[model samples]
Target: MEVTIIEDQFILKTKVFFNNQSLQYLKKITGSRALIVSDSIMETLGYLQEVIDYLQESGITSTVFTGVRPDPDVSIIADGLKLYRESGADVLVAIGGGSAIDTAKGILYFERKFESTEGKEMPKPLFIAIPSTSGTGSEVTDFSVITSEGEKVVIIDEFIAPDIAILDSTCIQHVPQRVVADTGIDVLVHAIEAYVSTKATDFTDALCEKSIKLIFENLETFFKDSKNTQARDRVLNASCIAGMAFTNTGLGINHSLAHAFGGTFHISHGRSNALLLDAVIEFNANLGGSADGYAADRYAKLAEVLKLPARTRREGTVNFMLALKRLKKSLKVEDNIRSLGINQSEFEDALEQLAETALLDRCTPTNPRQPSKQDLIRIYQKCY
Candidate 1:
């Protein structure tokens, strides 16, 4: 039988909406038991209780696992999974940033692994993700980044994609300006990498184009004024739109290198991506200071979309990189990892392993330029 390629995600399966407390869908949940995965910040912010109260009102008993940390490792997943298996829950709710959502996903992932290992298939729980931060876009994406032995592992699995995504502006209201900067820049990297990915298609490009425009228009205002509700909504939309794009088209080396670098140096994922953005862009587009291939043209197209200077491929690419640098400066995020207090000797010592791990990251193969281990080392060295 002749068959066509079936893209893992053609239409987003997750039901998405915006609200004040992310409580609009609580009444619609069909399950009686829920495993709520979250973190201390959500507990401190009272968002955790809000979700719990909502679930209680829906007549759903819940198991709360609030031990999720930034860049969740295997141990968190194992612990959460143990709770999940023991709770006998039919619903999984992740109510925090990417870390918390990923913890829930990781639990589900290993749950599936357990089924496979034991030659049994358990009915998957209904998964819902409510992102407190406008970065990672973990609410809608079918990918999860987990830290294992000081290296970030990107787990790509369609089964773990949330059944629903809730964007609650209230949760983001008190986000630190520095976090806003980092998260907002992460949205840009997602859009850019998806746009230039070798696997990109017209459908993905359209989402990426809109996402990029939204970030350029609204991110600065959102960062500067947390009270700007309009900007907040737009940034949130941009994040989800970019997620839709990259989850379909996959991402590139910016993510790959960021994953490795962030894990090793204990940098925030978004900040790591921001530090690597400029060099990754230039590397993908050029070799020896001249624009190289289709990736350069793709970048030039993005420049055109942003209405930057795109008269020629090189000019457009340079202007685009310059624009990103300007945005980073405005946000006070410098491009140097060392300035983040990573020891020079430790960094130099880690370069080889970083490059090796980054080369194996799921995002690397989609990079417009196929990087060698030496190439990654050079990129790391240049950024340092």
Candidate 2:
């Protein structure tokens, strides 16, 4: 018997604060100046001013950069970097969804990269992430995806992970129902992908299992009643836990396809993932032509963990894929890219390029089943 020694190393460097009033913890950090990165909607919703008020109450001066946009691009990051450089802030705070946090990480990343190239030293700011949505988990992950020149560029490095993650369900209480459903499904995809990833270990598996169960139990309640405090908190925590797991285990073709498709169609990231998830699951579970059974076995294991009815591995795999589709339907997510209002002719024209981009995505390497461009294209077509 060849025994595989799986070295279990679980590292989570970010200090997490989870509670109803977790933003108050910012007062404990001894920084005199703070810079907040967010978007216009946050500003309009008064979240921006609320954070600024909190900093002021803590005796810290603050600057606001509200230029982040959906599917943020290099230019958005450059703008944020310029604001941070001029703010004279010792602490950086990101408030909003993944785009805001990703922009903040991008600013810090490029600043360090540029400084290193110039042989100059710059003090790193203390980074804090306050996610207003219960998805993406960008707050605790060593990853940031920024669009540039018609491509979604994924940046992964320990340096980009926030120093602290503050999870307060109150922040997400006002999120639109549609957004709630979209982001909630995103949490499920994160957990499922992390659980089945080739890099998954015992630690990540535990976190993924817990996260998945939480989403399944709480997402529907949270979506229907955003004011349900317990449901909101559970879903929020699940998002962060999933983020932590995927940061270590990495994601799969689902994320790769989402990134590419979102970049091309300008679709919301979470919604894009929701649309393609069922197709990707079926693709990963298929044991056709040189296919390894690792992913299929993992999917079956997940179904078992969820206590879905199954008599064997094949039944479990089928049940797992069906469960995902049923969940999407319950959440009111579209079943295909065509339903998302994408022009069929344009989608067909872009399929090859999208497939190529997905094949090169950073998340693709850790996927249990490696996919070729043609394989990715076929998946895209099926989803279409």
Give lDDT tens digits, candidate 1, residues 1-384: 999998645658788888565556676678899999999998998988888888888899999999899999999899999999899999999999899999999999989988999999879899999998998888998999888877788999999999999997888888999999999999999999999988888889999999999999999999899999989988988998999888888899999999888887788889999999888887898845669588899989989998998998988898888888888998899769878888899999999999998899899999988999999999998898
Model 2, total clashes? 0
Per model, how many backbone clashes are there? 0, 0
TM-score of each: 0.96, 0.96
Query: What residue pairs are clashing in model 2?
Result: none
RMSD of each: 1.6, 2.7
Candidate with the greatest TM-score versus the true structure: 1
lDDT value for model 1: 0.89
